[model samples]
Target chain A: MHELSLMEAVRDQALAAAHADGAIRITVISLRVGELAGVELEALRFAFPVAMAGTIAAGAELRIESEAAECHCTACDAPFPAPDGCCDCPRCGAISRQLLRGRDLRLLSLEVV
Target chain B: MCRDCACGEPAPDPAAVPASAPRELTLHTALLQRNDAGAAALRQRFAAAGVRAVNLLSSPGSGKTALLEALAQRLDPTRLAVIVGDLATDNDARRLQAAGVPAVQITTGQACHLEASMVAEGVHRLNHQGISLEQLELLVIENVGNLVCPGAYDLGESLRLVLLSTTEGEDKPLKYAPIFHGADLVLISKIDLAEAVGFDRAAAHAAIARVAPHAQVLEVSARSGAGLDALIEALGLALPAVR
Candidate 1:
């Protein structure tokens, strides 16, 4: 998957943040990945070590929080739990809806020391 | 919690992590923020130059090239150019070039989709080929043909056009809702094959309405040239023939 490139970027950000915080190294990098973010968690776990090699994030623990997909129907503004490609509104049966979450891929924090 | 040694210890649980519990720095930064930054820069570049850069997204065999070719024959030759992205060959770019449009190919190799950085490089490569981005009125980016992967990556276009051919089926918008959700325009291509394929136009429109209520739907056929003029008009392109 494209997790390697994304992890490489996470490593870079971790290093910069650690440097700015005056830490000798990064201990952990926490990330929030949504279900609809198109990232494979297993691939991201496999890519972490290689992506962080030779950097401040070398061997740094990667914590990934998987968020569930949720959406709201565009027609009647009905909220619904959208997972596994289920996007229709239960209330209005309207297909079009504004996606409220489940597309996130964020680095929540960096444990540095 | 060491930076180097892995001494038979289990990785910490990702779910039980508290916002400010164990981490030293509460960064709260989006992991793909760099991609967002890149996209923002590209958007600014296009805006500054007043370029109408459209990112065309579709599944393979959705007639993106055919539509672009139709546009090539219709739009101003001097002002229109293309940047084609594909996983392997530059066949689409070659086809566009053959249609008399300045086309640059960005072969993504193993990548599934084209990123903003790749678009930047494509523009640079086009500049090297004496096809300046500034001179062109339209810069069409033919994204690697996949509805799923390209949905997340923004190539920073003025418009995002998602194409669904009639043969593909009516459930496409429902199945790949995210792609349709982000599209500025939803083009129903290959409408000429509707009769042969039993393509239900009403159902397709209904599906699109469910997923992308804001997207303007246009039915076009590159083969019979039906709705090609309307397609050009949708892009707000002042065709040479009309001029």
Candidate 2:
């Protein structure tokens, strides 16, 4: 799964940052995974420990903040949270909804010591 | 004397060992921040050089290679160089080169899609070969032929071209709408065979429009060179220097 690859990158970056800060261990790694990012949280969690083996981030708890899928309705000119499996404009019932964020995968914070 | 011997045998202190070090360290960093940072840098580089990068995505046998070969032959070599990605072989790269343009082949091993890091590496290799980004007008990265996986990764491209060959049914966009939603331009390839295969071009365009309301669709046949000039002109307009 791509989650494994993503986890490998995450672990590498976390360890690098911890090492740079002269930290002996990492306790928590915080991340924001957007609802539309198409990443499965359980799969990511399952892959993290395996990817973290031998790294400073090993055994560190992963904190994920999932953002809801959102879109801007071109027809209604309104911003609303997009419903699951549908991009239709909620207010106007038009199918001209443009995505407005909520598809992002960002690492916002890391707790290291 | 027995009491004195018992008192002389002192019990060991249980708190002698220092407490174990803290088991947690607070790290607040986006896991993809590093890749995003790299991609941003690459975007700035492309902008500085006035190069427009287009990342192309489609399933296998979707005519991406054929489209590239045709584009390479049509565009002036003084301006265009293509970087192609595939799971194996440099066959596409070879074809592009034969069409009289410089081409670099990126073999992703077992990876399903091309990440920004891989594109960064490919750009660096191209630079090492004396092909300056400033000299090139367009950098087309034909992504590994998988619509689903490639939709998740951003390759720092200015435009995202999603190809849907007529051979593949008209409902592909509806089934894999994420790729269509991400596309800036949709190329309907293999239009020459549409009549023979009973492919409906209008229905295909309608499906794409439903998913990507604003994406511009261009129908072309790489084998017959029909509609190739218009595609080239569109590319020229998209990347002004290519004209």
Candidate 3:
């Protein structure tokens, strides 16, 4: 799965940050996955151990925060939450063509010691 | 006089002086930062070489190769080249070469998507095959046959085209909105079989518009060569003057 490679990216970044900070080890990795990022949390979890084995982030707690998908309605110029991948505007009866957020997959913070 | 082994340094505040305490470092960065950087570099290279690259994305059996074959046949093969990605096999590359164009095949093994690094490698292979990027006008990267993972990876293409076949159902766009949302052009492929497959054109158009209103949609059939000219024109591929 692509999630495995994503986890490897996370591991590489986290270890680098920890090393730069002169930290001995990483304890927790916090990530913010957007709803429309095309990433499955379960898949990320399944890939976590495989990607982190024998690394400084081994056995580290993985914390994920989800960002809700938002779309900008082209007709009404309003932003609304896109639940279930439906970008239909709640303010007006218009399908939103602009996506405001929700495609982000960010590594927010790292807990190191 | 200092307290707690502080040599006159205002007695190190106890509230903030925790020994061996874990530190939380904020690093707000995209997960695909490396890939994004790589893609950006590729874009600059393509611009420098004066080559327009287009990335094709679709599920398996979506006729991506067939559409490319038709386009290759129409365009000047000397100025056009293609890079095909598959889990295993050079079948697509062989097909495009047989159709009269320079082609490179990338066997990704188990990867479902083609990353920027892979595209760079494929470009190297294309060079080894006596095809130079500066001599090409259009370079197409046919991504692996998956609608999901490829959406997240940008291979430094000038345009992104996604194909949806008539047999795939009208709701396919809505079901896979992420990939469709990122498309610059959406091709409704296999139109010659639409009637045979009972494909609802109206519903498909509606679904595509609902999800990808910003994308220009075109109906095409590689088998009959219908709308291939429009597809070529939309991609800004100019035919040879003599042809």
- Please tell me how candidate 1 rates in CAPRI terms: acceptable
Those runs of model 3 whose alpha carbons end farther than 4 Å from true positions after fitting are B1-19, B239-243
Model 2 interface CAPRI class: acceptable
> List-wise, what DockQ does each model earn?
0.38, 0.38, 0.58
Error of 2 at B209 (Å): 3.0
Better of 2 and 3 by lDDT: 3
Which structure among the candidates has the greatest DockQ?
3
Candidate 3 lDDT, B93-196, residue by residue in tens:
99999999899999999999999999999899999999999999999999999988999998999999999999998889998888887889999999999999
Query: Which parts of model 2 are misplaced by more than 4 Å?
Result: A16-30, A40-42, A60-65, A81-86, A108-113, B1-29, B127-130, B198-203, B237-243
For candidate 1 chain A, which ten residues in a row score worst on lDDT?
Answer: A82-91
**Candidate 3 docking DockQ:** 0.58
lDDT of 2 by residue, A1-113 (tens): 47888888787877777777677778788778876675778999999889888876788888889888677877677887764424667677676646776677776667765
Clashes of 3: 0
Candidate 2: interface RMSD equals 4.2
Please report the TM-score between candidate 2 and the true structure: 0.80
Instruction: Give a tens-digit lDDT track for model 2, residues B179-220.
Output: 677788898899999998889888897788766666788999
Backbone clash numbers for all candidates listed: 3, 19, 0
Candidate 2 chain B lDDT trough over 10 residues, lowest sum: B17-26
